[model samples]
Target: MLNIGVLVSGGGTNLQALIDAQKSGIIHSGRIVTVVSNKPGVYALTRAENAGIDAHVITKKECGSSDAFDAALCAYLQKMQVDVVVLAGFLAILGDSFLLVYKDRILNVHPSLIPSFCGDGFYGLKVHRAALDYGVKVTGATVHFVNEITDGGKIILQKAVDVLEEDTPETLQKRVMEEAEWKILPEAVELVCSGKVHV
Candidate 1:
């Protein structure tokens, strides 16, 4: 079985999806063994605690530098023997050290289809807002490996969600999460864990 570690900064709705997927046996070969949050008192930690998963905190300010935080994160993940790292709404910028150590082992779920409203300054509702502002007929989610470039990783899975005429950023975000992010993220994890994904 692949031991998974999740990094979070917010509500962790995607982390919940992974937990639920494991419980349902949908994720056949991977299990979320730890959840590390960048912020304290976030609902994501609560979610992790309620599920009986080990949870921790590593605030950037506490680490004193981004590099230190990234190094600490790498050490923690290695100590836990984590085989896969999932970025489930994790907001902190992990330094190159973490990326090099984990390589293709780290997975990230982006709110929009890549090569679109992704990269720096495009996160959370901003992604959905960009899609709406551009009046795209379809906006979806992408699950990919974590590389040095933000959202510029090898695509594992993608699912498209239709945009409604009256859709707001909030509504579009919800729809993408429900129809795409929630589904493909776990599926991608399962694929990696099962040794089906080549890289």
Candidate 2:
């Protein structure tokens, strides 16, 4: 089975979805080996622990520089024999060394469709706000391979949601997240694990 290492910086709702998918046999060829968080006190760690997965925090303060943190993260993944690294709301921009080592093995779920409302400073609610401001009739999520550039990876999957007439950032986010992210994230992971996706 493919062993996955999940990285998160927030509530881990997507992580939970992966766990649920694994249990429900939707994702049959892989299992989450460990969960790593850059911040302490994130509920993602608790979610990992509750699922009996090994979970730990590797704070930025612990590793003085981005290079140092990447080194540590690489070492940890090596030790765990992780086959894939899944970024679930992980905020840090990874160093080149990490990208080189993991390459196509790292995957991320972005809140917006690629080549549109993506790039640095576009994440979480910010993405939703951008979609609303742009007055786009349709906006959704993208699951892609992770590279050096933020959200610049090759798109593996995408699901679109309509931007309604009375949509606020929060409401749009809620709808899109439910209709797309909740399904696509886990499905993307499964595709990677099953050898169906190539970079």
Candidate 3:
């Protein structure tokens, strides 16, 4: 079974989807060994705790530098023998040391179709707002291999949702998230677990 570590920074809706998929036998061959977060008091940690999974808060404030934080995070994942790292709303940009160590084993879920509304300072509601403002006809989500450059990874899977003429950012995000993230994230994680994903 693939032992996975999920990293999250907020509500962790995607993380919840992974847990649900595993429980429902859609993903029968893997387990979430740990859930790590950089922020404190996130509901994601609470969800992990309720599920009885090992959860950790590795706040950036506690570490001296990004390198040090990555080192500590890597050490923890190694201790858990994590086979894969899933970024579920994790906002921190991972350092090169962490990427080098994990390499092809790390995956990320982006809220928008990448190479468009993704990069520095683009995340969460901001991405959805951008898509709406730009009057794009279609915007969706992407699941990709994690690399050092922000969202600059090989795409594993993508699902598109139409940007309706009457859609506000919140409305568009809700619709896209339902069709894109709710399906794509778990599917991508399953692909990784089943060894179907290649770098």
Ten residues in a row with the worst lDDT in model 1?
92-101
lDDT of 3 at 23: 86
* Residue-by-residue lDDT tens digits, candidate 2, 1-199: 8999999999998899899998998888789999999999999999999999999888778999888999999999889999899999899989999999998999999888887889999998899999888899999899999998888889999999999999999999888888999899989988999999976
Candidate 2's error at 98, in angstroms? Answer: 0.5
lDDT of each: 0.93, 0.91, 0.90
- Tell me the tens digit of each residue's lDDT in model 3 across 3-29: 999999998888898888888877766
| Residue-wise C-alpha lDDT for candidate 1, range 1-199, written one tens digit per residue | 9899999999999999999999999998989999999999899999999999999998888989999899888899899999999999999888898999998999999988888899999999999989999989988999999999989889999898999999999999999999999999999999999999947
Could you tell me every candidate's TM-score relative to the true structure?
Answer: 0.98, 0.98, 0.97
Candidate 3 lDDT (Cα, whole model)?
0.90
- Residue 152 error, candidate 2, Å: 1.0
For candidate 1, the lDDT comes to 0.93
> Which candidate ranks first by TM-score, i.e. highest?
1
Candidate 2 TM-score, true structure as reference? 0.98
Superposed by TM-score, candidate 2 places the C-alpha of residue 118 at a distance from the truth, in angstroms, of 0.2
